[model samples]
Target: MDKKDLRIVFMGTPDFAVASLRVLVENNYNVVGVITMPDKPSGRGHKIQHSAVKQYALEQNLPILQPEKLKNENFIEELKTLRADLQIVVAFRMLPEVIWDMPRLGTFNLHASLLPQYRGAAPINWAIINGEKETGATTFFLTHEIDTGKIIAQERIPIGESDNVGKIHDELMNMGAKLVQKTVDLLLEDKVDAIPQEQFFNNEADLKSAPKIFKETCRIDWNKPVEQIYNHIRGLSPYPVAWTELYTIGEEPIAAKIYSANKIQTEGQLPVGSISTDNKTYLQIACMGGAIEVKEIQLPGKKAMKIDELLRGYKFQEGSYFK
Candidate 1:
């Protein structure tokens, strides 16, 4: 079949998914329709916001469907009308069997992490939090279980010591986009080799999971080693930031979100969560093996600022510490 003649329906919602969809459209692939999250209210004004996919689809003048319920009879009928030979999902919601099985060529998904590992909602975040030296993207056929399908192709990338979720996300997003196009072409050419995820898992229990991160998960634990604490802060930096409670001797605890920090080896022993600051230029918190020099942070109701700027206005008196 001609690449452009194979009918395809794309499903995604976030900016991460946009890269892949853009590639397909730019390559003149037959993306007959796009399915994204329903428009919903957001922010202080509660204004309705279209998903990133929907916004891009509008720019490309592609047909869109936003079904409140995936299994709605009306939605199913409309989906069938597209008569898609293949379906591609990226950074999208879980699919029902009816929806995934409808296409003649079946559905494939682009996942942020290698299959059989980091196989859940927040793979990118978990990988960085775990202090992984490497991570990658994978394209696989869809089945009953989530992210457990047969692998079609994968592209690996290095995760530097300072790389955060944002950096890794962008890297994987572009790599995944290319893999999506590659997978589609393989389908058209009948050259794909689908390898079961089990082939790589000698011990399933040893595999790392990428469950969704929660508010409590982002809380800083100053009792941990410097390397662990550093990873915890950077892994969630710039979004759902790692937070701690800053309290003076008798003042109420203040929420402090740490965005950037570096480890400093201390000569003398210090209690965990103890704060050592000049109240002018630096703020360091003692941990298991060393202290972390906080560079950027945000206090409650205040904009994120450098340590110098925060020191100018805020004071952490002697005996103040983070809990």
Candidate 2:
């Protein structure tokens, strides 16, 4: 079958998913329709906002469906009208079996990690937090369990020593887009040789999960080793960001978000979370075995700033520390 004749129904929500959808549309693939989340209010104004996928679908003049419930009978009837030969999901919500099983060519998902590792909602973030030197993207068939389906194809990439989640997220987004197209071509030619998830791992215990990150998950524990603290900060950088409470000698604890930091090895022992600053250029927090020299930070109601810029106007109290 020619690529232009295959009727595809694409599903996705965020910017990460846009790359793949854009590739299919730009390459003249027959994307018959798009399904995205319902429009919702956002920001202080409470203005309703369309999802990234919805906005892009509008621009391309593609048919769209925003179902409040995937299993709604009306929605299912509408989806069936699209007459999709295949379905593609990227960074979208899980679908009911009825929806995934409806298409003739079956549904496939573009996941950010190389399965069967990091199988969950936040794979890119967890890989960096765990200090892994390598990670990648995968395309797989959808099944009953989340992210447990047979893999169609995978592409690997190295994680740089100082790479943050935001950096890795973009790299995989583009790479995953190409992989999606490749998977589609394989499907078109009837040449796909999918492998089960179990074939990649020796035991189930060796698998690592990438559960959804919460506010508490981004909290920095000062008692851990400097390397760990450093990784934690970078892994969540530019997003939910690692945070701590700054306690001065007699002042109330102030909350601060740490965006960038570097590990500093030292000799003498200091109280965990102890603050060391020159009152002009640098701010360092003591942790196990060393200190973390904060490079970028943000206080409540303030824009993110470099350490020197923050220190120039605000001074840390003599006995200030973080907890």
Q: Best candidate per lDDT, number?
A: 2
Q: What is the lDDT of residue 109 in candidate 2?
A: 99
lDDT of 1 at 145: 92
Q: Give the worst 10-residue stretch by lDDT in candidate 1.
A: 260-269
True-vs-predicted CA distance for residue 301, candidate 1, Å? 0.7
Model 2 per-residue lDDT tens digits across residues 1-323? 99999999999999999999999999999999999999999999999999999999999999999999999999999999999999999999999999999999899999999899999999999999999999999999999999999999999999998999999999999999999999999999999999999999999999999999999999999999998999999999988799999887777888999999999988876999998999899999999999999999998788999999998888988888899
TM-score of 1: 0.98
Clashing residue pairs in all predictions, respectively, total: 0, 0
Off by over 4 Å in 2: none
lDDT of 1 at 110: 97
> What is the lDDT, from 0 to 100, of the residue 36 in candidate 1?
98
Per-residue lDDT tens digits for candidate 1, residues 97-213, read 999999989999999997789999999888989999999999998999999999999999999998888899999999899999999999999999899999998999979999988
